[model samples]
Target: MSRDERGRGTLEAHRFYIGGAWVDPIGTERVTVRNPADGSVIGTAAMGNAEDADRAVAAARAAFDGWSRTGVEERLALLRRMRAAFDEAAPAIAAHLVREVGLTTMVAEGQSAMCRSHFDGIFDLLPSYPFSASDGGMVELAKEPVGVVVAITSWNAPVSQMLCKAVPAIAAGCTVVVKPSEQAPLCGMLLAQAMDKAGIPPGVFNLLNGRGGDCGRRLAEHPDVDMVSMTGSVPGGGAMAAAAAPTIKRVHQELGGKSANVILPDADMAEAVRKSVFGCMMNAGQTCAAPTRLIVPEDRFQEIAALAVAAAEALVVGPPDAPGVTYGPLSNQAQFDRVNAMLERAIAEGLPLLTGGPGRPEHLSTGFYARPTVFGPVPVESFLAQEEVFGPVLSIQTYTDEEDAIRIANATPFGLAAYVQSADPAAARRVAGRLRAGYVTINFPPWTAAAPFGGYRRSGNGKQYGVWGFEEFLETKAIVRA
Candidate 1:
C-alpha cells in the first residue's frame, strides 16, 4: 500500500510488460512477495506460465529484423534515453532492492547505480565497436546480432544482471525477452518502466516474471529463441543448456562459484585475514564470486582464525532499515533455512566454529537474518570449504606451502574467481597467473567497468563487461569477394 515518489502504489505484479506495454498474464496464479527484513508482504506478481513465455518469445522474434537493422545512432540514442531514465529511477530501484532483496541501503544504492553504469559503459564502447571489418578487400567480416535472446537473471543481483544481459544484447542489435528472478521481480519491473519511459520501440525489449521451471524452461526450448543467457544456479544453467540443445541455440551462462582467497606466507596476516572476512561477508555473502574459502599458511592458522573471528563478530547484522547495519537478512526464508542447515551439518561433522553459528542474531526474534560466521582449521576437502553457502559464512583452510595453496584453491569444480594476498606484488601476481579462474585479484585491484568477467570450467563460460560483453550477442559472418 506504500506509494513511490511517482505516486505509484506498489508495482502491479499482475501485469507483464511485453511489446512496450503492460499486459495481464494468462495465468491466474500469483506469487506474494515478502520482505525478508521483517517478513511482511510487500507486493504480489502474476506467476507467468509457459504460454506467457511463448507470447514473449514470439514478440521478440517478430521485432528481431527491424531492431537488428537499427542504425548505430538510433540504437545509441535509445540507450542514452534508457540510461537517463534509469538514473532518474535510481532511488526507487534501490528502495525496491532494499525491501525485496534484503540489501542495506548502501549496498542497494551501489547496485542501483550499476544499472546506469552498464549502459554508460556500453555507451562509451559502442562508437568504437568494430561491427564490420574488411580484410584485404577480398574478404569482409560482418558482426551481426544473433537474433532473439532470452535473458534469465539471478535474484542476488537482479538489476545489474538484467542490464548486463539486456544492454549488451540491445547494443549488438538483438531483441531480448528478459525473465528476472522471481525472488526480486520488482526491480525488473522498475527497469521495464525505465525502458518504457525511454521510448524503446515496441517488441524490442520485453519483461516477464515467473519461475525458472515453467517459464524459463519453455523459453529455453522455444524454437524462436536464438540464444539463452542466464545468471543463476548451476542446475538451472544445465537445464537451460539441455533444453536449448534440441534446437541447437547458443547458450551463455554465468553460474555458481566456490571462489578462494589465498593469503600467502609473505602477506600481512592480520590485514589479509580482515580483508578476506569482509569480502566474504559482502552482500551477506550472496555473491557468486565471493571469496568464501580462505586458504592460509598452516603455521599461521591460529592467528588467521583469531583475526577472522574478530572480523566476523564486528559486522552489524540487523534489518535493512536499522541504523548503521552493515548487513541484513537473507533474501528469503529458504536461504535462511539453507544456511542454518549447512551450519548444523558443519557442527555435526565437528568443524570448529570460530565466531557465530546456527541462529539469527540475538537481538532479532523474527526475520531471515543469519549471523556472520567463521570456521577455521577446516580441511580443504570439507563440505564447508567446497560448497557455495551464499551466506555470511567463511571457511578457513591451511596450506603447507605455496604450491599447496594453489592446488587447494583450484580443488573445486568452480573457477569463477580467486584472490591472492602478499606483501610482494610479484609473488601475488605469480599466484594469480596460476589460478584457473576467469577473474583474479592480487591484493584487490580497483573495480573497473571494462574488466571482462565470467568464469572457467564449471563456473560457466563466456565473458561480460566492456567489449567482450557486447560481443556476446553478436555473430561473425565472413564474405569473400574478388
Candidate 2:
C-alpha cells in the first residue's frame, strides 16, 4: 500500500484510466473532487466528453476479440490475481473513501470489507458459473459476452457499485467502460490501477471520470456500447434507457429506494430501534438500501418513538476524521439544501420533529451537517414517508396492525429493500416473503455479499453482488443443427 506524509495510505490520483493506461481526458473540461467533510478541493478530475466515451468504447470493443474467447480456468486465474491486487490496495482505497468521501472510519472500513467480500463471492461462484452446455444431440447453449458494457455508478457507494459491476463483468468475459460519478471519481481511479497491476489486458477495462451528462450520456448512446448498467436514481436510469433505446442496447439499472423496516408488536422494540437508528444513519443515510422508513404498531408508538428519538438526537455528527463522530457531512451542498428543504416542509406540514430539525451543528459550522432528525406520529401517506430523504433524517410511522404495517411499507413507489423484526421467526419470515422489495432482512440480520442485491418496481431492474449479478452481463445464444 502507498503511504503519504501522514502515514495514511492512499491511491495515486489519475485523471482517467483508459485502455489499461492512466491518462488525462482529451477534452479540456474538468470537475473538482471535493472533501464533503469541509468542501475542500481534493483534486481535479478529467471531465470526459463524447470523444472520451468513444475512445473507451472502442478500446473495450477491440479487447473483446481475444478476452471473451478465454477458457473459464484462465479467466478464474486472472480474477484471482486481480483479487490479490485489490487486497494489497485495500488500505489505500479505504483511506481514500474515508478522506475523500467523508464517511466515518468504521463505515469506510466496512465498505472496504464488503468490496473484498464481493470479490471472494465472485471467485467462489466462478467455478460453477455456466458457460456452455449441450442442449440436445446437435444443439448447444453458450453464454457469451454482451460486448462493450457501459457502466455508470453513483457517488454514495462508488467503490461497491463499481466493483460489483466490474468484477462480474470481467468474470463473465465482457469488456467494460465505466463512468464513475464525478463526485467520487478517485475510487475508480484506484480500482483501475489495481486492475492494471493485476496484468489484465489493455482495453478490457476502461474508466472515465466526469459528469453523467458528459461521459455517462455519451457511453449510454454510443453505438459500440452493447449494454449499459447503472446504479443511481430513477431519473438516472430513465436517462440511460432513453440514450440507449436508439441503439437498443441492453440496459440494467439499480436505482433509489425508500426501504421500510417494520417492527412487529411482539418484537424487541429497544433492540429494533437501536439497529434501525444506526442502519439509517450509517454513511449518513446515503445508502440506497438503507431502512429509512420505520413502521411500528400503534400500541408501541410512544415507546418506540422515545427510544428512536433519543438515539437519533444522541448521534455524534462532526468531521469524518473526528473520533467518536459517527455521522459525516452530506455528499455535497446540493444534498444539504435538499435535506434542509425537506425538513422545512415536514415542520410546516405539522409533522412533529421528535429530535433534530435543520442547519449545521452548533460547534462546527463550516461543514455540511444535518442534525439527526427524527419524525414521529407521521402520516404514512405524507411526502416525508413516501419520498427518499437520503440523509440522516428518519421517519417513524405508526400502524394499526401487521396488515397495516405491510400496507404502509409497500405503499412507496420503490421496492429495493425491507426489514422486519418479530418475536416469532415464522412470523418474520412470512412478513419478509410478503414485502415487495427485492431483498428483506429479519431481526436486523447481517448483510451478505454473496446474496443478490437489487430492487423491484421503480427502485430498479437487475441484480448485483452474486451469481445473479454475474449473469447480468451475459447473453445466452442457442445453436441448432440437423
Candidate 3:
C-alpha cells in the first residue's frame, strides 16, 4: 500500500467523519475492502449502524441553521477553498480508487478530476443564480435551503457521485451527510480529508461508512434529514423513498439504466460502432448511464456486430497498474459474480456471443475480471437487453426503422440516458428530442459539466449538474407585500 508524506496510508479505514471529527462507529462489525484486480485485502472499514447515522444526521442538523444562513459570497469562498484542497488530494484519491475500486489509473484520475470540476461548475453558477426574484405584482419569490441533506452514493464513480450531491447541497446552503457505498469508501474518506484541510465548519459535512441496510436505512428514515439524494439501483431508491415517506422528505434519485445507442443508417457506421463499443466498455461498463444496448438498422446488424466484436476484443483488461491495460476488474466480488451469472444466463438462452462470454480472459487466471463481451441479435424483451449487467458486456439489437429504434430504446423501464448518431445534426437532434431519457448525446458530443443530468421514469427523478443540480436542494417561498 502507498503511504502519504506523513507515513499514513491513504485509505483511512477505522473512523467515520462526523461533526467535523473522526470518530469510531458504534457497531464493531467491519467490512473488508479487497483489491479487485488481484483479490487481495486492502483494508477493513468500521461498519456504521443506526447510531452512527443518527449522530451524523444530528451533526448536520446542528450545523444547518448557521450554514444555511450564510450569504452567497461566503459559500462561494468555501467552495473555492474546497476546490483547491481537492486538487491537492487528487493524486491520493486516484491511487486509493485504483486500489479500492479496481479502476484503471486513467479512469480513476478522470473521476477524481470530476470532483473538482463539479465544485468549479457550481461556484461559477452561484454568482448569477436567482436566489430571490420579484414578481411584477405584490409578492416576491425566494429560494432557500431544504435543510439537512443525506447523500447516498454508489460504488462506481464514488468521488463524482458524492460531490455531485454534496457540492450542490452545500452550494444551496444546506448541510450534508454523505453515505458512500461500502464497496469503495476510501475515496469518500479522502474527500473528507480534503474538506478537513479546507477548514469547512464542523457538522456541515460528515461521512458514514456501512452497508445500505444499516447506515443507509437509518439516514433515510431519520426525521432530521430533509432530503435524500441517491445514486444506485431502482430497488434501493424505492426503499429509501419508502423510509422517507412518513416524513415526506424530498427524495432525488439517479438510479440504474439500460440506455440505448441508436445509430442511423446514414451515419458513419465504423465510427459510430467504435464509439458505441467504447461507451459500453468504459469503466468496465459499471456506469449507471452506460449505453449498454446498441440499436441498429436490420440490414446493418451483422456489420455493426462485427465491428463491435473487434472493438471489444481489442480492449486490454488486466491489473490497474499493468502496462497497456485499458480497464480493470469489477469493483467487488458481488458485482463480479452478478456479471458472470448474467453472462451464463445469456449463454444458456442460446444468445450468440460475438467475442466473449462466461469466464475471465485467458491471460487472467484469477481476480474479479470478466472478459469484455459483445452479443448480437439480442431481442428487446431479452433479459440481456432489459436488465443492467453492470459489467463489460454489450448487447446489440436490430431496429427496422427510426420509429422501431425509438420503440426499442424506450422499451426498457430505465430512461436515464440515450445516444443518437446521424449524418445530419438536425436529424440527430430530432431523434434525441423523441427519446424518453433525461439526457441524450447526439453524435458523441464532448461531456460538459454544465449540462443537466438525471433520468425519467424508472431510472429515477431529479437532475444533477450545473444550475439544475444546484436548484434541487433549494425550496421556494413566496412573500406577499402588505
Which pairs clash inside model 1? none
Model 3 scores what on Cα lDDT?
0.88
Q: Regarding TM-score, does 1 or 2 come out ahead? A: 1
Look at candidate 2 and tell me the lDDT of residue 156. 85
Q: Candidate 2 lDDT, tens digit per residue, 83-188? A: 8988887777777777777777788788878888778887788888778899668989989988888889988878877888888898888998988887787778
Q: TM-scores across all candidates?
A: 0.98, 0.96, 0.97
Residue-pair clashes per prediction, in order, are 0, 0, 0
Number of backbone clashes in candidate 3 = 0
Candidate 2 RMSD computed on C-alpha atoms after optimal superposition onto the true structure? 2.0
Candidate 1 lDDT over 1-482, as tens digits, reads 24477423465567888988899998778888888988777788888999999999988988899999998899999999988888887888887888889988888888876777788888898988888999677999999999999999999889899999999899999999999988887778877887889999989999999889899999999999999999998888998899999999999999989998999988888888888888899779999999999999898888888889988898999877677888899998888999999999999999988889989989989889999999888887799887789999999889999999999999999999999999998899889999999999888776677788999988899998889888899999999996
- Taken over the whole model, the C-alpha lDDT of each candidate is 0.89, 0.85, 0.88
